[model samples]
Target: MQAASFTGILKAIFYMIAFYYIFRFLAKLFLPLLVKKVVEKAGQKFQQQQQHSQENPWNKTTAKDEVIYNTANTKNPRETKKVGEYVDYEEID
Candidate 1:
């Protein structure tokens, strides 16, 4: 009785592993093609939009951008040089 039950359990486990490998193989074969189709469709839509539009918001220039300097002041600020005041090191014994 125990032997039959053990055999059935082993068979079930083997079938589960086989099914897992089959699913993984199918995914590997078709997943990339599915992704490629989605990307191509999106790219086609974007190209159509660009061809129909004259001025793109992405390329528009704003008033703030025309300023000579992005900073508050127009003249460049001078950076102060930093000098080390002191240094110490230990000698090998």
Candidate 2:
């Protein structure tokens, strides 16, 4: 490959600096709008959840039922279901 001249090196440095500043300027201009949109979406979701929880008492009860069911089933369920069987093994050398 041919050697890079001083002018070529200076042009490359100038192009890199130009791109860096352009990126920084664009980010500064758009980052706030992006953050605002995300915050608005989260706020809307929070309000929806609040409205749902307020409207549906059964929804809250179902969540509690799930917690209770999980804990109760692991220990002593009302209707027992066999999951697995114990096996006895002997090793000989």
Candidate No. with top TM-score: 2
Task: Give the alpha-carbon lDDT of every model.
Answer: 0.85, 0.89
Rate residue 79 of model 1 by lDDT.
Answer: 71
Per-residue alpha-carbon lDDT of candidate 2 for residues 38-88, written as tens digits (9 for 90 to 100): 999999999999998789865454434543445756786577779999999
lDDT of 1 by residue, 15-81 (tens): 9999999999999999999999999999999998987675565667676665464775557687787
Question: How many Å off is the CA of 41 in candidate 1?
Answer: 1.0
Leading candidate by lDDT? 2
Measured with C-alpha atoms, the lDDT of residue 77 in candidate 2 is: 55
Error of 1 at 37 (Å): 0.6
